[model samples]
Target: MSDIPLEHVHREPDSDTGNAVFVLHGRGADEQDLLPVADRLPGDRHIVSFRAPDRLRGGYTWYDLDLSGGGLESSQPDPDGFRRSLDMVAESIDAAVDAYDLDSDSLGLLGFSQGAITSLSLVLERPDTFAWVAAHHGYLAESHADRSPDGIEGKPVFVAAGAADQIIPASRSEAAAEGMREAGADVTFGTFEGGHGIGPDELEAVQAFVEEHD
Candidate 1:
């Protein structure tokens, strides 16, 4: 576990409901980046947006990526950094729950790109931590494939990817969906018509998915 403190933005619902959603930003983005999307979610839930721990350029990253080789095969994710971020996220969630008197059973997670990778990792590593998860334009890290054999049989998962995403190919997204299914999660996977970013249609689908499980 890491000793680093997590930076976050918390939005309380109008009615002060105990439910909460943890929103994670993509690479080069901060905690505030996903606040709008969290606001648009279909619920009276509290929103907590967390910042990545690692500083990269002017923004932040959950883990360092090594693309020294050629293709995705040569790319390497920093395992140590990833683990630290995971710990930080866990700590943040606990703190949020306590501070807001939130319902642990109603907790959900949403992430984009690098944030999505970390979110999925958290769900896989701690299957009972989240009620539902939405991973956008992300993949399961190769390093975490052998952690545990325990399956998330009843967990609900939504995965959205762009068919023309240049940064993360559709193949990676498909493989991620397959992996989640193999882990026994009830997975809802979809591919959009655009590039490496989220669109209105994708957000609508995610809203519906979350509502279904909420």
Candidate 2:
């Protein structure tokens, strides 16, 4: 994975509940970008904000999905490159879980845009690594089909999208939700009033979703 360590922001759960939230940042952003979302969520949840492995310009990226150009294939994943990056991100998650002594069954991933795409890839790659995944304004890269995790049946999932989002169109969002459903995730998809970003109301829904799943 480029032999570079992905930086991360961590927030211990306010209560000793042993639950945690892993936050994945969007393109051109670092771990700090999503830390505030963690804060806005339930305080009792331990939170992790992870930077992407590749540093393009001043921020980071999960894969090459050209967020800058908005073209069809600017930053699209080249199978090999994406595999390496995904492996490192998964390894980070494993280490984070072990370091915190957290239960994998109670773990969740929260990502936005590029982060969301990475989150979906992570869940698909591991099969049963997380209890829940919250993807905000993100979609799976092409050709990645959905499948059920071996052991974690009924795995919960939350997806949020902006109706006017020009970056990752609403159609892609629906496709993502459908794909997750086909893969057997207990999916909850919501659309907001804005575009390309998460709003306060969306965060509230995310908060409620996590609490309910936990």
Candidate 3:
């Protein structure tokens, strides 16, 4: 894993509750860019936002992939990069749990775009590490799908996507949802009327899921 430093933003909801939501930002964005989204969520829910590990030409990147080929193919997701990011995030979760004396069963993750892909991968890679994962407009890497047959049997998952999205097409998102379902995760998938970015309806759905799971 790359030894990268991270910037974090946190919000503690209740002094007695240990439940927390770990938020991951989208591409070309930092922790500060997405922390404001927390304002729309429950004020009482503990929120933690983490910046990406790598600084690209203009922004940040969690992993590397080729987009010049017209269609995303033969691209590599930096395992070391994701490893570092996961370590940082995992440490943050542990600290939150300890600081709040939280029940291990109440920890959740919220990720958007590239963040969503990372969040979903982390939960799958370490099946028992999290209670739930909220994936917003991201799909699983195709390479990861057939590598293992094991699914997150007990973990709850919420996936929100835009039907008109051209960047990551709705078909791709649906396919990921199907894969998760076949893998035994309790999945909740929703599609909105927009494209690429999350809209009000999607946010509302995410808020409800977080509240119910958290």
Highest TM-score: which candidate?
1
lDDT (tens digit, per residue) of candidate 3 on 23-48: 88877778776666666776366777
Q: Give all candidates' CA lDDT scores.
A: 0.85, 0.78, 0.73
Give me the displacement of residue 98 in model 1, in angstroms. 1.0
lDDT of 2 by residue, 3-120 (tens): 2255777777757776888888888888899887878776477787888878878998776653454575233555766777778778888888777777777778889988888888
Clashes of 3: 0
Question: For residues 40-148, what per-residue lDDT tens digits would candidate 1 score against the true structure?
Answer: 8897998888899878778888888867657653355677888888888898888778877889999999999998888888999888879999999998888765544
Reference-based TM-score of each model:
0.93, 0.88, 0.83
Better of 1 and 2 by lDDT: 1
**Cand. 3 TM to true fold:** 0.83
Candidates 2 and 3: which is better by TM-score? Answer: 2
lDDT of 3: 0.73
Please give the TM-score that candidate 2 achieves against the real structure: 0.88
Q: What does each candidate score in C-alpha RMSD?
A: 2.5, 3.3, 3.4
Better of 1 and 3 by TM-score: 1
